[model samples]
Target: MNPSSPDGHYFSPEPSVASDPRVVDVLLDGVDLQLQSDAGVFSHGQLDEATRIFLDGVPSPPAHGNLLDLGCGYGPIALTLATWSPGARVYAIDVNERACDLTRDNARRAKLDNVHVSTPQQTPADVVFDAIYSNPPIRIGKQALHELLATWLQRLAPTGVCYLVVGKHLGADSIAKWLTSQGLRVDRLSSKQSYRVLEVRRTDREQI
Candidate 1:
């Protein structure tokens, strides 16, 4: 999760802090990876607990389809998805340009060409995701978080599913109810360490 910064939040389009890069080692799906991270981004020096739990709880991604790593901070989720599903396209999007750059560099370092790193606006509008995995920015406040989820959740393919890990204290249950009110099916896949893993699917063929 992104901590508050004196200059700006990690969600800022451009962070004001100077870059202090570091390498973060992450083990996902029993595969070890060394990725690049930097200041002014979420979990800069290491994998945050929420993301680690998220990775552990979620199932393997689709073998060949468009996959989305929403709010991808420094490429952990996106890289793992790309690594495991070489046939699939992994889109890693974040509002922070620094985060996007790091994800791009990390993807290159990992030699995963299938991962596409971009800002939310830079992503192609025509593309639809087969699955979306995220540890959403819950601290962005309830309204902004709701808007962000609504925007992307609408982009899910008819049968697409979204797996999100949110802290129970952060209102995971409330978010699930809100998603359901938006005409999506929400299921609690698991809960660990005060975090809830929610599986969201469109209730109908129509866009939510």
Candidate 2:
């Protein structure tokens, strides 16, 4: 879903496209939200189908703990998690500064104080996530995607879980195999609309 824009890729640190902001109306878990979106970010105008499916399928987040929304675009997943778990601290991380700014603005507009919008490097190094949700930028290429996942997955709490939605055509099964090879436990939670929703956890927690 992260195709190159006229100026640069959506993953670019600073997108070169002119600002074109808009309000996106989204309904998650029966909660209505008006989020600020703009050009140069992923799914600028509306919630993409993959994310819609991912949100609809994932289980309820932890009641209170550190949560992460990786590759957060315009704060849809991050804001939704904040709405769902008001007590949780939601870290919304992205590489695009424009996207990060949009997320911060949207969070402020929604009055969700629990969300922390930042670039990956800006996230506190000592924080461990209780849960992570992502509709990753698979188009970033396999090596980059692998590195990105590895970095964050390592930050998962011992008993933490990461829920991801990847398209079947985009090699969801292969990613599961790769995660398994890395000594993580991967389960296909559901398959809908050619997308695979994966539930991942540390294998060491199996005995617990």
Candidate 3:
């Protein structure tokens, strides 16, 4: 697979891998999911630990409204969000074309019509999310990660919230402080297995 970015783990703009589909079976909230994956996507073999932790750590999302699965890899978070909130529109955004293809396929296999897989450039600028979920691409480095998070976090509605999972060694605490300093309210919702689950929202809604 052609490495899209320097760190090189499926943050590619266009992956060189052939359209060979693979399978990943994951159990979210006791529901088993067999998602279509590919060689060039993140955690293509199976669900990654950080994502599993994020899924387990987060509560069921709001019943309705638009939601985002930032840096979606084969649509796990997006599909899960669609399953958990049937009335919501789940946007699965990824920079990798191959990953986007896999995500679209997985959404179809899951029989979820609500999942919209797209690249960052394709997502509407005015679209605001009710909630955002990610096991973010921290390996992309601090500067890029900050830019990515800032871009999406700014798209959060006034009452929107974002659930993110980052490993302790990957600067979870520092990232939280950085987010807070940017005028977002970041709270540690859970810390388990060397991973931190951060709950983020607009500063004005901090008390809400």
Candidate 4:
């Protein structure tokens, strides 16, 4: 397990929190959701603003296909995807074992059988996703964040798209430029509350 800070390390492999789980309620698409969260994960006290904006900006996923919630801290994005796209297989990948544990229980509580929570290494390398969503871990540092994006972005299907939200103060523009330079099409879907909602697609074909 990667060494972690117990207070709140979304990327922690093994969080040391004493298992004080809390229930959080969030409304999405007019439906109420109760999620289990704890101290060791990201934004455990409430749904972070960036994620709420991401959810508001990205529409319901495709009805049937593979979907990924990268850095799925306690499964908000993953669970939402599972609930919104019942036919799709939603994979929630997180390094923090406690976050994964919370997500698993949350999914079960929600009666969602389509969620698969695991560490990145446990995910099948051969599987590709139709769409991916995240409010990425910006504090993870530029090099590490770039590598994280590259590892999974490469697994996107030819026509796949990724939706992300990053705070402007967190260098959103820099990351967008970097992504474009790497041969992906980057577009700003919205900017609100100092956050940028970015939509990325592979430049697999030349534009006319």
Candidate 5:
């Protein structure tokens, strides 16, 4: 098991405090999703710049069956993904209980009962994602961040893909190389404002 975070990593299941609730709404690929937020969580009041860039960079999933919003905070990406793909069942996982509760409530408010919001450990064993999307927490340090990604990358379905947004200064290029070394093909699809949108997949193929 990885060591518990001193930085109060957002992925830590045990949260520090309960933030006051507020609501936020956004349009993603023509779908409008409204979710609640609270203080101290990632992008609590409105969509954070990184996630905004992430959404802007990537197109909506053509088809969604099983999806994951890794480190889903207050359900922005997860809720938007579900709204965009009605056929998808999104597992919104976070370590913060308050964030989890907020996601659950926000999904309920959006009338999207298909989103399963809970802690990382609450996710079932048999679930394999068709798509995994996240604005991964890079401040968590390289080793810890890699561990987080590694745990979930293995959960990708045979043809599944993950969309990630990372700041350029945070070693996004090195991360791509590392993923490539892991046999997961990582493509730097787009870059802007020193941020990168990476698309990763696993296959029986050689490095480029």
Candidate 6:
């Protein structure tokens, strides 16, 4: 673990593990999704705790346009969203190029043609999302992670919402408060492994 990396998780632009990553199967919402992950991606070995909490709280298949998994590690949430909501498209984005590639492979193996995996900069700037889901990278420290979340949360469509998973020990309550103060309606949807699942909605719709 490199102390230089905040979480001792090397999510470098160019990671040292050069060979193609190995494939691993993850169970989400009772469905299996095959993913390829190595050093640079989040939860390289298996499903991370926060994501399990988020998956446990995911209500039902959302009904339309695009659902996004920001900071998607290897397409589990993205693939699950696509699988659950056949009518909607799923976009998986991450900063790690290797992670993006792994997501693409996972989507391909799952036979999901509609799931698009891309780097943060590759997504069209004009695109708006119907819903966003993430098990945020909280260990990156509060301020940086907040900035990351704020950027994507602001991209939600008028009727959109974001589902987030953050551990209580990692300041989930403070984040919920922060989102609420930002004029986004936030609800604590579930609690597991001392993690809080948050549901966020934009406030502008109150006028409608």
Best by TM-score: 1
Q: Candidate 1: which stretches are off by over 4 Å? A: 1-7
Cα shift from native, residue 119, model 6 (Å): 1.3
Q: RMSD in angstroms, candidate 4?
A: 3.1
- After superposition, which runs of candidate 6 have C-alpha atoms over 4 Å from their true positions? 1-10, 17-20, 205-208
Model 6 lDDT tens row, 115-183: 989888899887889899988877767788878888887788878888988888889999998888788
Better of 1 and 6 by TM-score: 1
Candidate 1 whole-model C-alpha lDDT, 0 to 1: 0.91
Q: Write the per-residue lDDT of candidate 5 for residues 15-108, one digit (tens) a residue.
A: 5644567778777677687677876477778988888889888877746589999999888888888888878899999887878988898888
lDDT of 1 at 139: 76
Clashes of 4: 0
Per-residue lDDT value at 193 in model 5: 93
lDDT of 6 at 167: 83
What overall lDDT goes with each candidate model? 0.91, 0.91, 0.87, 0.87, 0.81, 0.80
lDDT of 1 by residue, 1-208 (tens): 2346644678888888878899999986666899999988988899999999988889888999999999998989999999889999999999999999999999988889999999989999999999999999887889999999999998999989999999999999899999999989999999999999999999898876
For the record, the alpha-carbon RMSD of candidate 5 to the native fold, in angstroms, is 3.8
Off by over 4 Å in 3: 1-8, 17-20, 205-208
Instruction: Please give, for residues 132-153, the per-residue lDDT of candidate 4 as tens digits.
Output: 9988888788999999999899
Could you give me the TM-score of model 2 versus the true structure? 0.95
lDDT, candidate 6, residue 196? 88
Candidate 5, lDDT over the whole model: 0.81
